[model samples]
Target: MAFLPTSYEEMKQAGLDSVDFVYICGDAYVDHPSFGCAIITRTLEAFGYTCAILAQPDWNKDEEFLQFGEPRLGFLISAGNIDSMVNHYSVNRRRRDKDNYSDQGIMGKRPDRATIVYSQVVRRLFPHANILIGGIEASLRRLAHYDYWDDAVRRSILIDSQADLLMFGMGENTIIEVADALNSGMKIQDLVYIRGTAWKTKSLDSIFDDYIVLPSYEEVKTDKYAYAKSFMIQHENQDAIQSKMLIEPYDGWYVVVNQPPLPLSQEEMDFTYSLPYERTFHPKYTYIPAIEEVQFSITSNRGCFGNCAFCAITSHQGRIISTRSVESVVEEAKTITKMKNFKGYIHDIGGPSANFSRPACDKQREYGACAKRECLWPRKCPNMKVDHSHYVEMLDAVRELPGIKKVFIRSGIRYDYLMYDQDDTMFDRLVQYHVSGQLKVAPEHVSAEVLDKMGKPRKELYFKFVDKFYQKNKQFNKNQFLVPYLMSSHPGSTLKDAIELACYLKKIHHTPKQVQDFYPTPGTLATCMYYTEMDPRTKKPVYVAKTYHEKLEQRVLMQYSYPKNYALVKKALIKAGREDLIGNGPKCLIKTYPPRMVSKKKSSKKHIDK
Candidate 1:
């Protein structure tokens, strides 16, 4: 099918007087399945509903929001693929100059909180219209939690936006149920009890008896300990088979969070990705930077099991790993090879956690992921099924396709999981062909204490993985490097820990071009630690580098090679009481004096070192 209506003219061209749903988005419209707006709108279209796109509407103009008029079913809203605040600002709370998801890499097209902003405009223009909010922003912020940008705990987006309902997690099936219910003449408020959704009511009298009551907005707002305790409960009950209905008390009403929907099967995945996508950005736009890389890429799976404390995939997409069939993936590959700009390359292959193409174990379906345990954390579970043979076979199939030169896995494959698998063939193949110079992996920190707090394995695992990576490179006669994505100032990381990381990086003769300071956005466990200053799991006090000065000090140590960061590094070294690291010695992190520079004089000195 052609791209969904992006303009009023297109809606009329499609012979529709009014669309069933008009999707307001924070991103420029792209019809690829990787984008949530595309999938949700397309899913609605597949169900015989006419859907139109109001992509990145000017939040200040009510007229722009009313281009498609009021919808027959309801208006669906999403903060694009990423949260808007994260899209518009940096971890340091600085406004970003460019937006990769915007048209021609521009910023400021959307507001600070695009989901809530867009919803307000929709409500103003269409007073009686039904509004449904979804996507990562709404999903993660559905409960009252920490907001890093605001530097405070903010109530649920549902309360702030005043939307009719909030859809959490991947909402393909639940959305269909919602639409069908509304289509059957049910009011939005009465359309409760749907899984993977949250709605507000004045009282809990109508709520089913089996539900877990979280700390009230009033208590959690005033008490950090209460918020931490509440997060642990929300974290544990995410499983489909085991989750209890969650209800949180706000001012006058209660926000009822239903149990998460079960994961989509392989067949559902195939059907979803098989939808006729334009496979690129909307035609009206001349360019969209996000498409250039993913245009040729294919996602083979959905959901993640990595359970990184800093990542929200578990809370938003769940921990169950579900994959599309190899045949479906191969077909997508063939289709890409025939595209207008086919370049004989497929950029990436996996989802939330790449290399995870199946559930952690066979029993995951009947019995939910062990409520209290992880599949590959603390130590690899003996019952955990680990193999890369299916991925290897799929890669082989794609690479064997006609007109295919390289099938790179740009989306990161978890290094820990790769090491857990006993087989070495996939590793060898990856080093030999899939890598495009460097393979990326997130070993967030090197300190054992910090790694433990991040829910990641210690330095020993990263060292082992690095050793094996280089060994495979040597065996395959490939010179590909390992690019480790590192983080700074995660809850437990101290100036001492950051210095230790810098020393390790120096020993390895590597300096990263970029470093991520822990961003405490909504529902992640790491965010809980950042906000509460306590580990939610044990409710034990944990040290946190909360001050911007301290966080900058930690970040400076990571990139000490830069001349601009030299002063900060020296200050950090001095402040952390590691004066031993300030001399002109191999063990020293920085010199006592700046490098000499020649003074520009009209008289004599040509190149005097300063």
Candidate 2:
């Protein structure tokens, strides 16, 4: 049933004639054609070795491995689209029989099911291959990690995954150097000298000396509940220092951290946009029935300017938006139309902060000048600039392309930046050409303190933009709706904040059913704050959301439209001192919450008395 050559022997006979020096196999989501994979594979291509991307392959099945016959199998490279280290830790922690493992203040929680399954498969299929694992997940867990979910300290994923080397950070430069060395007949052991990778060394006889020493499973396994609490208190600043402790050796397997964030140059951006992207969905995989079926993707830019405390983009791509040219983007659009399966609409064309076409500050010369901890809050950056001409042109070209009916801006666009448009022309253009009934924007949180902590715009700005957006829609007779993305239980959020946000939503009469809970990801500032009460590097006391009730309230307030949620919303409002909004108020939930609550409270009292 697998789409592979008949057998391993058959694959062997097919030979290395068509083989490339390296074969990359891993999660396709991270090795996205526009982002991670494009950068890595192109970089390897630059070094004169043919590198084939076996993206999201079923490494667990022997048949999947046979599709690409052995090409000397230089090194197995994996980094993008895998589970976050925190997610992995959470899985391990949850498996433990302990109540001490809590969600804490993490955001973007996803299961590590793929990585665990894939790693096992790769270990079995490619026993002789030099397996190198890196990416956000592997990098963050390169050293001994105290998994809050697992409630115990765990060893590095590299050792457990059976990878030969582990490269960390943005792997473009490091992966290139690695491929070049291997092509030159250098041994895998020789790759330890690289600055941005983690690998085992022959000299590492006893234990990894560079990483922070954590309690072994044996020491903490029996009393893990107590051990987790102690570990949380002791390593409160673990997130910030976690990356710093990974050391680089002069010669052997070492961990690389603190490498200056790599901003894709204009040329690199052009190359990415130049790739032959068949914007049409692959029909064979279309039966899976997901958004990818109706939607197509194109990257207008790479990286983001908003370095929110909870985000890994700043750490990974740095706070710079490298954009592609209008011509190149149009060319890709044209190619999409030529495809037989083309549905005539390109769903999304943007990347980390789509509105950030060109960064306000020149990072190369003015790196330290833009070192402010937050960008979206306070709006103090005089350097903040907007270039909508390219976007305008790109949208125009996309519309003009044959068979393409609509081009949706599916990715998150910075509302604050978009608001800065001198005129409503961009919004007008978006309404006229881009939107498909709904436009998505992430307001994150409405509470000022919470927004500040999350490095997002003030609540007022979100409302202001919503008003303006709707005003434009009404003026243009457009039926498009605005969908705001909200994050709950961030580091500084509380029940009061959640209640205030809920009240605001009620005031606007806006109800969004899809809201995400904050899942702390690795290498993010927010995660560090969650893990340790202090800034991992600064060791300064910071506000953190630790209670479950507050988290629940935050979630309930975000979607208080349903009758079932009215009591919860009213309770949250009352708890937050916003009882005035409870009944017959502009945002009153009396119609939904009042009747149910009175009867429920009486029933509860009756039960208590009995």
Candidate 3:
């Protein structure tokens, strides 16, 4: 199979004077469906268009971006599979040492905020090209929102990037419409009515449809209450069928986002995956750490309805689940078996949530997700349809394939939804064949108050799931474990809450090796809470562990069993008035002596020796 051109020589060898689009990216050119740049380029090729890739162009020099030259149509830009800021820095805002998307996991290949930087560079060169930016960075920052890196509200990325249009969400269908419009001699300015897109305009006179004008950028920037109110409105209007156009005003121009694209149908999903994909990184690099996990994996579905507070899936992919047909997934599995390094195993056959292979309910699929409530949070909606029979059947089919020995589900599974399913067939199958000794599930926190803020189910639900998992393991005579994903320092989690979590961890005899601190990324409800110190949905005051020391203590509490964390954990326990946990009791988190006292005793002995 021939790969798309990424340099001038390759473009010429392919015998193309000028291509339909010049796709610029902040990631190495990996021609796999998992990467957004690859999908868009391949999809355009299938639809009678020529495209060349400019992956990870050097932002400081014009030569890197000029390699592919100006395109016949426009330039399509993405900040790779991950947001550039998140990839470059940690929650502590410390520069990260490795970039998985870069060649050899090296850092500094791409700039921080690569999308804006690349777009600005291209704009300077091309000046009049149709610049369209999308992917996680553009999608989440489509409107005026909070930027964690800047530590303040930022304008819409479209305005900053000076792009003609911004495609939000999974833009397979959206890109096709855009290409068709541009091909028919339509200017980017005239393509405003397209769904699943946001653009910057100077006037609201052309907006003839029903729309809601959000609080002006200035208002949300200054007033936390206005910011919360603005976020609540956007969250409610995320549905495709029932959503109206949303407009956000700036000083002179405005950012208008059209209703999201409808979720892909089964046939459409099949077609998208069926396109030609090299399914590996380009030959230029000997290694790319990002490919190791996904090289053998298959994305069976897209989109998520499990609207966790910290996740940005609802903002980017929306809350509707769209899955591929069983045949399509099986075909992809067959392809995997024939690859150069074929193994008898399929690493994963999953998506956002493995078991969520269908919509939450018939009403959600036909009408739209309910604006007032989440499908599985605060309690599963009465109308929610909880079943796993089809998922079980698909897994059975995949595992039974010719060269497949095992098909594992590695994506996060919604334990609450799994428990809600009446049929134990999928649950039985999961325990029987799917799990790899341990299944990972996210039970972000144990305290009810913190879980409510995180939109996770009650701790009681997690305990129930744990008991049922072990019961199934015993029934099948297998020794399996449940590795619960824990989070620390999320909004509404205080010192007392952290101590309670530590006590729960002590009771369970499981201390997580790695605990994630809450990162205030854009377009997430939890981020809003972290910044505003209030639940945007209810407008109620919420506590946030904003101080560095408090965040450190919370993280230490989760991993309190480690020898190095003794001092911090002891300090946290004492500060929370839970000094009872410091002594050597059966349920105590740490030993009696603080590390400081031990150090002081050692120092005294050294002084006497001197």
Which model scores highest in lDDT?
3
- Candidate 3: where is the Cα deviation over 4 Å? 594-610
- Compared with the true structure, what per-residue lDDT tens digits does model 3 show for residues 32-120? 88899988899999999999999888899899888877898899999999999999999999999999998999999999888899899
> For model 2, how does the per-residue alpha-carbon lDDT over 483-532 read when each residue is reduced to its tens digit?
77778788777777777777667666666656677776545657656656
Residue range 86-194, candidate 1, lDDT tens digits: 9988898899999999999998888988899888888888889999999999999999989988888899999999899999999899889999999999999898879
| Candidate with the larger lDDT of 2 and 3 | 3
lDDT of 3: 0.89
* TM-scores of all candidate predictions against the true structure: 0.96, 0.75, 0.97
Error of 3 at 17 (Å): 1.2
Please report, in order, the local distance difference test score of every candidate based on alpha carbons. Answer: 0.88, 0.58, 0.89
Among these predictions, the greatest TM-score belongs to: 3
Residue pairs clashing in model 1 are 596-610, 597-610
Error of 1 at 207 (Å): 2.2
